[model samples]
Target: MAQLFTPLTLRGITLKNRIVISPMCQYSAEDGFTNDWHLVHLGSRAVGGAALILLEATAVSAEGRITPDDLGIWKDEHVPGLRRITDFLKAHGAVAGIQLAHAGRKASHSSPWKGGAVVPASEGGWTTVSPSAVPFTENEPAPHELTLAEIQQIIEDFRVATRLSLEAGFQVIELHGAHGYLLHEFFSPLSNRRTDQYGGSFENRVRLLLEVTEVTRAEWPTELPLIVRISATDWTEGGWTPAESVQLAKLLKDRGVDLIDCSTGGNVPAAQIPVGPGYQVQFAEQVKREASIPTGAVGLITDARQAEDIIASGQADVVLLARESLRDPYFPLHAAFELGVDVAWPPQYERAKPRRR
Candidate 1:
């Protein structure tokens, strides 16, 4: 049997299979409101038979967005639109998850299609915030260093976002601590240089993420899964490393994080990454074994056999696909066939199901 097709339980939620639709930003929202575009984009995946459909890095606050068009769960009003998407996903037998995020200094950029460059306030951009007053790139404007009070407010924002996620019916909540975003900014020495309680030493650097998780877990229901996605490495010297990832994963597991979605790089622009097929699987494997927690392996995992190997060999509990899921929202359904697993198709598409050779 294909291990990828087997059920994997995290907390009280049992994923129907090991395939997860990693969050891919649509960059289609306005004022943090989801719309028909989101419905079709996410709904189609659920209809295609993915075991879990995770929403993109949804901002915990409006100003935390990486781009003005990124999705937001910052307000109570954002719940209804999200509820619609979650309903559609659940009705189709896919678990609905959301990634709560803050972009930090990486905020206030234009959408990818619009060059993905930093936008001026005149063009709808706003000043970004970070643990330190550092720019992601030297050419980019330096962001405001967050004061201690501001950090407390952000933690409260995450707690409120968790409440809204519950109201919107998300079964899983993944904290976005990867991709050189807000939380990553706090942990990566390349970005965070504070000498206060929130930075400097390893424990201090990870303090913000841990505090955020603790507050979020308190607000999030005990019955659901709470996952954190981390960039296991900055891929640069003296930056966040795989060893630190394992240590952090251990701490997170103790604080009720059910799984670690392992991916790498993004903290430093000058770092060289050896990207390839299953490039970051080792990070997930290390976290899973060393931390003794379930993990979701991500990054360049695009084939059925490769995904199956990861699960069957006990490398990771789940496989998350981002770009491949875009190219084929129905990847899971097709993978079921490739691996000889008999998963159901949506009734409307049953007539087109692949038959045995």
Candidate 2:
């Protein structure tokens, strides 16, 4: 069997293979409710035979949503809709997961198709908050600097979101500590310019994420897996670096984090990033080797052989697919055929399963 086809066990969850459907924002929800669109979008991947299906970045609160359409889990009423999706995923043999996120200074933006501009209070957008009163870009209005009390509230929000995920029947929770989101805002110095306990030194900059992890782990079931997706580098000078990612990975492992999903370059819009196939894989390799933790390699990983080599060479424990998965929901099934691995096809699709020559 190809190494990519082999099972990977994290905590009590044993994924049938190393292919994970990376969380990709759909921006297609109504007041934070999941509907048939989510069911079919995520369920198709599960039926296609990916071992783990992580839902998109789900907002933990209304104000945290990047757009009015982003899915949310802030209230108890959202559980049933989410549970419906999880039920479908598990039935199709995929472990259901969700990424809890907050947009912070990046909040109140129109969806990508809508020009990706900032939406103002007059336009149904609320005031955005962040670790500091900084805007993501100079053209955008400055967000309100979070007070100490507000910081505590954000922590509680994560705690509550964790419980809500459990109720929604998800087996994994990946905190959105990457992509210049709220948690990422707190950790990256370029975004975090606070003068208090949550900023300045390395220890201080990472405090919010650490605290959020501690609380989330406390609320999450002991047997389930918890993942943190982080941009391993800011791709700019004097910004968050690979060394800090390794350091952060070590700290997360100590707090019961199961994996570090290594991604890069979302904190700064002007930061130059060398994008290409497996470009960010080096960060995953570095974190796994230095921090001695399981890491998932993401970013432009598109084919079976490429993914196989990543796991075969021991560079990363798993491979996460975002755009490729979007392009091919059955990438896992196609990959199995390409690699000559006899992974089972769903009975409904058995007639369509390709035969090895």
Candidate 3:
């Protein structure tokens, strides 16, 4: 049987299979509100037979948004639409999950369709915040360096967001610590050049992320799981390394993080990343082995056989897919056929199931 089609449990939540819908930003919200587009975009995957369906990079504060259109759970008003989506996902069998994020210096950009450029304040963008004032690139504006008070406020934002995610009925919450976002900024020396307690040494640079995890855990229910996604390496010399990620994963696991979703690169514009199938899987393996915590493998994972091999080989506990899920929401269902794994299709789609040759 395909290990990818087998059930896996974290905390009190049991996913029907090992396939997880990796969080992919839609850049399709208005005023940080989720709408019908989000409903269909996420819900159809549940109906298509995924074990877990995660909402995109949702902002924990309005100013933390990657784009003006990014979804937000910073306010109580955002809970209703999220409730609608989670309710539907649970009713259909998939465990509803969400990735809570703050974009840091990467915030205030146009949506990809609108060219994804940094929008000036006059063009609807607000000043971005980070552990330091360093901009993501030369063309981007220098962000406001967060003061001690502001850093504490951001932690509260995550706490409140976690509370709202629980109230909205999501079973899993992933702290977005990857992709050079706010948490990633704290982890990457290239992005965080602060001399305060939030930067300089490795321990100082990791302090904010741990503080956020502690606060989030205090607010989130014990029965639900908290996953933290980390970029295992910045892929540059003197950047955040896989060893640091392993140590961070161990610290996170000690702080009650259930899983480490491992991905790499995206810290600097000029960092050389060796991208290919399973390119990032070794990081997951090292973290899982060294930290003794479950890790989810992602990046260039496109086929059922490859996903199953990752799990079967003990490289990762979960195989997360971004582009593959986009290409086929029914990827799991199709994978079941190819891997000789039995998975029940939604009755409405049963007639469309592949037949034995």
Candidate 4:
């Protein structure tokens, strides 16, 4: 069997294959609620033969939303619709996962379609909060520095979200600690300038994420897997580094995080990231070897051979596809055929599948 077609077992959860549908924000929710669009969007990927279908960065609080339209699971009301999506994904043979996140200083922005800029409070955006009161950009307003009490509350919020995710039948939970979001900001020196227990030294900077993982682990089932995505490098001097990411990954693993999904940059506006096909794969390779943890490689990984090579070469345990999946929801199914891997197509789509080799 092709390496890409081999099942991966992590903490008692077995993936059908190595292909994962990376969480991509739709920015189509209202009051952080999921609707039919989520079901169809995630369900199609499951049916397309992805081993994992991860929901987008779901906010743990109303004010933590990336935009007014960002999906949320802060309330019990959000569970029902999310359950529907997870149910469909699992029924179609994919593990359902959710990325629980808090946007911090990046919260309350206009959607990418709206130019992806920060929104004003008068425009319905709330005051953003972070480890420090730093603005994402000079033009954006400074966020409120989180108090110790608020930090503790946020940790509890993640724990609650984990419980809600399990209740919705999601088998995997990934903490959105990357991309200069709330947790990433704390890790980056450029954004986090503080003297508190949650800031300053590297240990202090990573404190919130570490604590969040611990609380989440306590709430998330022991048999289920937990993942944390981290910006392995901020692509800027004085920013977070791949070396730091390796150490953090080790800490995360010790805290029960099964995999480190390596993606880079996004903590600062001026950081230079060399973007290309499989550009982020090297970080995963480094973390996987040095940190001795499973890693997921994402970013511009669009072709069957490229993904298969990643697995075959031991670069990463899972290949996460985003824009490519959007361009073709059935990319995994097509990939299976092209790579000579015999993944079963749903009975309804079997007749539509290409002729066997």
Candidate 5:
């Protein structure tokens, strides 16, 4: 069997294969509610033969939403809607996971198709908050610096979200600590210029994410896996680096984090990132080697052989597909055929399975 087709066990959950559907924002919810769109979007990936399908960045609070349409798990009422999707995913033989996120200063922006601009209070957007009064860009309004009490509330929000995820029947929970979001804001020096306990020194800067991880791990069941997605580098001077990511991965491993989903360059707006095929895989390799923790390689991993090599070479434990998965929801099934690994297709589609010539 191709290494990508082999099962990967993390704690009590065993992925049928190494392919994971990276959380891609659909921006199709209302008032943080998952609707039919989420059901179909996630359900199709499960049907397509991926071992795990991580739902998009789900906000832990209304104000944490990257856009008004982003899915949320901040309230009890959101559980049933999410449960419906998880039920479908499991029935189709895929592990259901969600990325719990808080967008921080990046919140209140319009969806990408809607110009990706900030929506003002008059336009139904709320004030955004972050570790400091830093704005993501100079042209944007400065975010409200979070008070110590407000920080505590946000942490509580994550704890509550974890409980809600359990109720929603998810098997895995990934914290969105990357891509210039709230948690990322606290850890990246470029965005976190605070003198408080939550910033300044390396240990202080990582405090918020560490606290959130502690609370999330406390609320999340031990049997289930917990993952953290982090930008391994900011790709600019004085920004977060791969070294910090390795150090952070070790810390997360100690806190019961099962994997570090390695991604990069979302914390700095103008950081010159050299985007290309499997560009971010190097970070995953470094962290897995240095930190001795499982990692997921994401970013432009488009083809079967490319993904196969990632796992085969021991660079990452799993390969997460975003745009490629979007382009081909059934990428895993096609990949199995390409790699000559005979994986079972959904019985409903068994008649259409390709045969070896």
Candidate 6:
């Protein structure tokens, strides 16, 4: 049997296969409300045979949104619209997951399609906040440093968002600790320059993420799994290192985190990343071995043979597809054929599946 088609169970949730649809922001939302477009977008992947389909970085608070158009769970009214999408994904045999995030200093930006520059307060963007008054890029405006009181509010926001995720029927919750967002900003010394308990050392730097996970875990059911996405490395000298990521993953595992969705190099915009197929898989492998936790390998992993080797060789427990899945929603189903794994096709589309020799 192909290892890529093997089942993986985390905590009490069992994935039908190791294939996952990584969260890819659609940048098509209205005041945080999901609509028919979201249903079709996520639902199609469920039909495509991915064991899990995680939603994009859904802001826990309105300001946590990466852009004005980012999906949100800050208000109770947002639950019903999200429930509709979760229902479709589950009905199509996929486990629905969500990445709760706060963009922090990176917030208040125009969409990438709109040139992705900073959007000032008068232009519908509000003042951005972070662990320190640092802008992502040197020339951009420095964000307002978050007060201790405001930091408490961020934890509460995550708590409330976790509860709503349950109400909306999401099966898994992944905290967005990576990609140089709010949680990442606190932990990476390159972005954080605070001297308080929230910064200064590795323990202090990672304090916020651990707090959020603890607070979020309290509200989240024990039966379902909790995943944390980390940048693994800032890919710049004197920034967060792969060694630091392994240590962080160990701490997260001790706090009841089930898996590490390992990806790297989102902390600095200009840092040169060695992008290639399977480049980031090594981070996942290192963390899985050193931290004694399951990891998911992502980034440029687009082939059945490559994904199979990743799982089969014990490099990572799961392989998440982003752009590849967008290019072919049924990549998993096609992969099964390529790897000679006889998995079921959706009954409606079974006729179109390629025949065996």
What is the Cα-based TM-score of model 5?
A: 0.99
Q: Write the per-residue lDDT of candidate 2 for residues 1-357, one digit (tens) a residue.
A: 799999999999999999999999898998999999999999999998899999999999999999998999999999999999999999989999999999898988989998889988898888999988888889999999999999999999999999999999999999999988889888899988888999999999999999999999999999999999999999989889999999999999999999999999888789999999999999999999999999999999999999999999999999999999999999999999999999889898899999966
The residue-by-residue lDDT of candidate 4 on 45-83, one tens digit each, is: 998889998999999999989999999988899899999
Q: What TM value does model 1 have?
A: 0.99
When summed lDDT is taken over every stretch of 10 residues in candidate 6, the lowest stretch is 263-272
lDDT values, one for every candidate: 0.94, 0.94, 0.93, 0.92, 0.96, 0.94
TM-score for each candidate, following the candidate numbering: 0.99, 0.99, 0.99, 0.99, 0.99, 0.99
lDDT of 3 by residue, 89-169 (tens): 999999999999999998999999999999988989999998888888998889999999999999999999999999999
RMSD of 5: 0.6
Candidate 1 per-residue lDDT over residues 91-143, each given as its tens digit: 99999999999999999999999999999999888999999999999999999
Q: How close is candidate 3 to the true structure, as a TM-score?
A: 0.99
Candidate 6 yields a Cα-based lDDT of 0.94
Global local distance difference test of model 3: 0.93
The segments of candidate 5 whose C-alpha lies over 4 angstroms from its true place after superposition are none
Q: How many Å off is the CA of 38 in candidate 2?
A: 0.5
Give candidate 1 misplaced runs (Cα > 4 Å): none
In model 1, state the lDDT of residue 232.
98
Highest lDDT against the true fold, candidate: 5
Q: Candidate 6 at residue 283, lDDT?
A: 95
Q: Which of the two, 1 or 6, has more lDDT?
A: 1
Question: With candidate 5 superimposed using the best TM-score fit, by how many Å does residue 74's alpha carbon deviate from the native?
Answer: 0.6
